[model samples]
Target: MPNSPSAKKALRKSQKRRLVNRSNRSALRTNLKKARVAVEGQPSEAADDVKTAMRHLDISAGRGLIHKNKAARLKSRLAKKLNAALTES
Candidate 1:
């Protein structure tokens, strides 16, 4: 419980931010999953999926929702997988 008025307002703002961040993170995960699936199931569409996922990651990182290094690592891993799949096909 927040004792001061300012504290209460801060708590309220944090709750709202939490909800928004959760939604954004969920969408990011969904996009990553789609990219992974496309990599494994359809090489032709993998590039576009990867692009979408990377864009989302960049946006999330820019907004401070995710770390920039984390986003870069994820992008690297996904690109590696995509390349491997493409080469194998």
Candidate 2:
């Protein structure tokens, strides 16, 4: 329905971007889930997954895919869980 050339190009670009963002977001969610489950298991093993998830969060936030504050909060909570698990073990 885009009559203008610029609008058509913009729509194309947005569709491409949407696909990329969706893939990245899916990966991020998977990482976060793994990290969370790991945190509930063993401290030593969980640390690496938590670090990976945090890295993904930071990268996604920097790329403007997610809010910086949301990223920070998730990282903080994950770090806290990791620390608690570490202390308990």
Against the true structure, candidate 1 reaches a TM-score of 0.97
Q: What's every prediction's RMSD, in angstroms?
A: 0.6, 0.7
> What ranges in model 1 sit over 4 Å off?
none
lDDT of 2: 0.95
Residue-level lDDT of model 2, residues 6-86, one tens digit each, is 999999999999999999999999999999999997778887899899999999999999999999999999999999989
Candidates' C-alpha lDDT? 0.97, 0.95
**lDDT of candidate 1 over 10-51, digit per residue (tens):** 999999999999999999999999999999999877899999
Off by over 4 Å in 2: none
